[model samples]
Target: MRHAETVTFGGSGLDRAAALRSMPDLMDRARREGTALSILLWRGKPLVQAGSLDQLVRLPMDHPIIKSGRHVDADSEILLGREADGTLVFAHDMSSWLPAGLEATSLNTFLDASEQQHPDLPQDAVFAELRRIMTSLNARDAELAATAKALYSWHASHGFCACCGVASEIAQAGWQRGCPSCNAQHFPRTDPVVIMLILNGNSVLMGRSPGWPDGMYSLLAGFVEPGETIEAAVRREVMEETQVQVGAVRYLASQPWAFPTSLMIGCEGIATSTEITVDPVEIEDAIWVTREEMAQVFAGQHPDIAPARKGAIAHFLLRNWLADTLD
Candidate 1:
């Protein structure tokens, strides 16, 4: 776990200027001075340049699309952080705007087709799903985009104050929502999920959910319930899903999974029993695969299994486990 922070969306030591966020005219100053760097989102997808999919395209605060009132009147505007060079970074959610007369495509297909319709924006810019190309992005861009997506998602769902059931106003530079009626403050939430590699001798326990792509299996994972520890969550999840008791859970690494914001706590657990009683409600299938079989799956040689998605924590833990580097 020495290299744990190298995981995707792990903190890269960006300067999150908390003090600047409290200033009353922060957004106003950014708009007038042109000293802001804006990350653009289209219905929760980050904007990327067309040809070079690896690079993320950031818009200047004064750019045409950003200035065109749609972004100025964004659904949720977040102050992400500042750079070492003193550039203010922000995120503008453009989920409310759509290209006129353009037929809506599935989230999977919008990435490739959206760029062709928008002639007003940069010729190379296209909105793409973050999960599809997370590993290709550099550390800074990955962190910023993940932060933006998480914040936007929180705003979309949590419009009302939980304490008083009153509508809340955005405050504290998008980190908080303030309720005037009850004087309650609400903060962003990150649910903790335990994803464990359960080991029984040389084999590992893997499971696939009902709707996952065919042949896609990953490490057993479940959310940490109220007052449950990470270790307990891992053991309970494995037992509940596959009826296999786990012991000696050890922390491995973690990643910020921003598909609506969940912190994946990776772990390795030793299984005490080998019974395979699959819970049909939770998982479609569960199996014990040896290291050799996993290697074949990773190399695209396995007949009936697809490897875990490349940028996910499951894939990272498995790769390190195979290399004997999961210390």
Candidate 2:
């Protein structure tokens, strides 16, 4: 775990100026000082400029063309940061405008086309574009995608205030929603998920859900229920899914899984029992694999198993585990 922060989306020293959230004058001053830039999001996807796939594609703060756009009004933008003495830092939304490749395309159609090519886009490029220019963005692009997807989904479902039957207004830089009638503040939520590598000497346990692609097994994971501790959740999830007894859980690392706002807490657990008895309701299959077998999966040489998806914490952890770097 010495290099835990080196994981994708794990470390990026961006200054998330939290103190500037409430001061309007400070934010304006920051913008005027030219230290502010806009990250644009279109339909939840960050807008990446062509060819700048490795770095954040920031928009010039004073770009005349962006300022003249009809939909580029003040309300569509949010101030994200300010310096120590109060300076405006901003991010703008161009979701109302067409993206680079889809100038005349509809959002729905554009999404469909993009999905088809998603697997082919360079990981760095995809990550760079979404991290800076999108709503719900993170310092890492994939994390941003996950954040945007989750937050937008929440907004879509929680349009009405839970405390009172009134519409809520977005606030706190899209991180919260407020109900005017009931005076309630609702913040964006991140669910806790425990994903663990259950180890028995040289072997590790993995499971696949029913709907997953063939041979797509991953570390056992489940949501941490109310009142459950992380170690307890790891034990409970393993028992529930594979009927295995786990002991001595050790924290490995964590990733901000924006897939609808989940925080994946990765851990390693010592298994007391190895008999596989998968609960059909929880997992389609559970198996113990030796490190040699996992090496094949990672190298794309496994006959039946596909490698874990890139950008996922599971993949990150497994890769490190294989390299004996989980320490």
Candidate 3:
């Protein structure tokens, strides 16, 4: 595999059995015959080992907690994919479960460190924010966690159909929604964003959003608007945000960012102009950093910048850039 394929949340060869989605009896049969294993999610947090938050805590399809979840919401079961062992795997949304003395207000804060335990689950297992445990899980678990979280988030916000403005029903084993009123089908959509590594000689451009934690900066990125290609987006976003003119844009890597589902297309760009004019409305600040300073930042020696967040495509790209491995 190429180095880019090793990015966090990258695929682990999970066979998404798309053909079996039309079989209405498939899920029922799998669950009834105790032939499937399931991972659990509360809100967007995944059930993982509490202390280390490493491995995903998979439960039998017939486990009591999952059975109770099925009773509450029959549509909660989502067919993730089949594992290599030929075992069916599913993700159960247990978001409806409420623990005692819960501070519902602060459930999913910016970086939620809290974990909630389901009474029926083992003491060591708890629901944790995927962001907090993403790097700890193996590639397979990371892919599953990211997939399940993004799917659940889409369902929660898209209960109503866009075409008919009416309630839609989940279909295709949670892969799509169908509107009965207008018969409009909506599939899960991933927003495409272009993150640029604009290099001018020995320096690269970086920026931080308005509310980002202090001293944290990343490659300039923005959603690819309608009628725009990835290269177009790279140039446009860099120009729009920092008044930089980019030339010769090339794709480097791509990452599945599941914080509400975005495909971050990484690109390298040659900066024709280095001057920056910040658009306060778009970002808080923008600046150029030398490769030497970036090396220090990654090593925890930079005085003004926080380390690049691990598991983020920004970090992956920057690390490779420093190591000369962006092949």
Candidate 4:
């Protein structure tokens, strides 16, 4: 955990400016003064300058896209944070718009069409899947993208009051939802998931879900159920997935996985029993991989398996495990 902050979306330390969120007058004034920047999202993908996907494509508050986004009156816009000089940053969801004459397709195709349609926008600007480029983004971009994705996803789904089934209004700069009918309040939620690297001797236990890309496997993971501790969740998940008894579970690092808002709590667990019993319903396959094989997988030289995707906590943990640097 020594380098935990180095993880993608770990710690960018953007000033949230919490006090300003509740102050509608100040927020409006700031927006009117053109001191705010907007991060645009198309169907959950962040807009980035296409080359390398290393930086976010930030549009000024008055930019055409931002203006059109406001005109659409789409989903809730969340205030992400402010930069060091106090310029406000906001997330604007623009999923409602589509290019004329371009048929909508999957998320990937939609992103490409969005960029292609905007000839007046920055030449390199395009909506990019965060997962595909998260590992390459700098700390600040990663944090902003993750935060925006999570907040926007929350508002998109929780539009009604759970208490009274009445439509809820956004409040507190998109950080909260208020139910007018029941006078109840709701906040953004981050689901806790325990992803662990289970070790026994020189090998680690890994599994692949049913629909994962061919030859790809990752550490065992599951949601931390209600009233369950992180350690207990780790043990339970490993046991349930692979029938591998685990002991001495401890935290390693964490990553903000904003695919529908999840917080992946990475941990290292000691395996007490190595007998393999795959849970057919939970995972397609599970196996113990030795340190040597893991190294080859990371190097892209393995004959039968590819390593976990680069941005995920699975790859992070496995990389550290190979280097013996998981503090």
Candidate 5:
């Protein structure tokens, strides 16, 4: 898609400097050079210096304020990277520290709060704030969020080792949890979800899950079950949701949806049948809308339909598809 990379959290071409991830000497040198900056996460919500660039905020490691919030112990290592200017970048996990206004709330509660308030957080103002403090964030922020949230959730739910039912300890910069009793190593997990646009000429299939706001519809999606390929998942999900037979499923794009780590595998599927049989358990409704109708929905002019939420892969893929760039 021509504007695929232009989307928020799309490829920003940041030079991650991956070779340095394992080199302690190089990492130390970069840290001492004052090029090392950290992005702070308060209860999984990235800290934004109100009115800054994109969503960028500062995390100077040596700053007096940060030193006062020394939650990381000497035994813990942080994830580090390098900026284009040879500066070091790090991700700081403040899940240990109590977040302001969130001291008594659990992580799940915090996430719920963020979701409920996100639409109200002035987007342009937040982007402006992020831009003022940092030039840009690497596309990997989405990946990192996915990794961290998945791992953290795993640790939260799997405090006991699966091998021996013993408690596990966080290790390897929060990447792994070790079971002292059984020597078991546990890692983060990601669930694969297939979101497909099933097309029959000019119209595309869309559905809405129960409980979603009225008039909201999106591409049919479902989790890829064990031993299922992406193509198989797309076909199965679409068939299961709408009883619409799909053929020739092809990959289009992907997004890391980190509401506890899901990889959204976007695809295009050719419809072999148009007859709709809604799975009342899986979806509340299903319908096909032509390109012209889709254009109206995107423009918020459809009297009975609402467009997909911005910044979501559904909207991203739909926009590209309408522009005939879903190549």
Candidate 6:
């Protein structure tokens, strides 16, 4: 846990300007006086330059897309945060725009390699999947992209009041939804998930869900249920999935996983029982991988297993484990 906060979306200290969220006058001045810029997201993919260098595409507040009131309406402009130069940054959703020759089936897949270009935008810029380019982005861009994606996704699903079942309106500059009928407010949610690194001796416990590609294995993980401590969730998840008894759970690091919205809490546990009993309902396979084999997998030389995807907390934890830096 030495470089714990170095994880992706760890944070870049964006000012956020929370005070301006409630001040409509300041927000309006930022937009009207050319002090604000916005990042565009089309179907959850952020606009980025198409090149080896990863750069998030930022557009002006008065950009045609925003002015057109198609992709982003007045109420939908989400205040992401502030830049170092005192520039206000916002997030605009372009989910309404349909690209030419857009393949419906190709999107939101395991690996969405396809990129979409807007006719109104620059030739070098395209909306690409955040997961594919997450590692390429710097800390600031990663944080912004993750935050915007999570906020927009929350708005899409929770458009109604849970208390009264009536439609709610955007409030607090996209940070909240106000229920007019019941005076209730809803905020963006981040579910806590415990990803466990269970060790019996030299080997670690890893598993693969049913849809994962062959040769890909990752640390066993499950959502932290209501009223359960992180340690208890780790033990329960490990025992439930693979029937491996875990003891002595401790926190390691965390990552903001915005594959809709999840906070992956990395933890380590000592496995008291290592006998494998695969739960078909939970995971397709489970096994204890030797440290040597894990090193091979990370090197892409393992004959049977592939390494966890880079930039993920699982890969981060396993790499640090290999390097003996998880102190």
RMSD of 4: 2.3
Each candidate structure's TM-score, on Cα atoms with residue i matched to residue i, is 0.94, 0.79, 0.96, 0.94, 0.79, 0.97
What is the C-alpha local distance difference test score of each model?
0.85, 0.67, 0.87, 0.85, 0.67, 0.90
Q: Please report, as a residue range, the 10-residue window in candidate 5 with the lowest summed lDDT.
A: 126-135
lDDT score, candidate 4 = 0.85
Residue lDDT tens for model 4, 1-327: 899878888888889889888888887788889888888776677888886677898888778756665433464578898999888998887766665654654455312333332555688887777777787789998999999889888988999999999999999998999999989999999999999999999999989987678899999999999999999999888888878899898899999999889999999999999998998999999989999999999989999887887878899999999999997
Clashing pairs in 1: none
Tens digit of per-residue lDDT, candidate 2, span 158-201: 77788987998877666578899998988777889999989999
The superposed Cα distance between candidate 6 and the true structure at residue 230, in angstroms, equals 0.4
Give the winner by lDDT: 6
Name the candidate, 3 or 6, with the larger TM-score value: 6
lDDT of 3 by residue, 1-327 (tens): 157878899958778889878887977887788778998888888899889899998889778766755423568778998887767889888777777878654665657887888767899999898888889999999999899999988999899999879999999989999999999999998999999889999898999987677899988999999998989999999988999999999998888888898999989999999899998889999999999999999998899987557888899888888887877
Please give, for residues 1-327, the per-residue lDDT of candidate 1 as tens digits.
Answer: 888888888858878888887885966787688778788887677888786768778788788877776534444668999988878988887776667664755554412334432555687787778887688888899999898899888888899999989999999889999999999999999999999999999999999987677899999999999989999999999999999999899999999888888999999999999999999999999999999999999999999999888889999999998998998
Backbone clashes in each candidate structure, one number apiece? 0, 6, 0, 1, 11, 0
Q: List the residue pairs that clash in candidate 2.
A: 1-327, 27-88, 30-87, 30-88, 40-133, 146-258
Clashing pairs in 3: none
Off by over 4 Å in 1: 100-104, 108-117
| Residues 1-327 of candidate 5: C-alpha lDDT, one tens digit per residue | 545565544465555565664566766665577767766554455555353233545556675535555753332335534556766666654556543464454344311423111222333322121111222444655444334445455556777899999888876545567899989988767789999889999999999887677899988899999998999999989888889999898888777665656778888999999999999999999999999999999999999888776667888889888988887
| lDDT, residue 140, model 5 | 57
Best by TM-score: 6
Runs of candidate 4 with Cα error greater than 4 angstroms are 68-72, 100-104, 108-120
TM-score of 1: 0.94
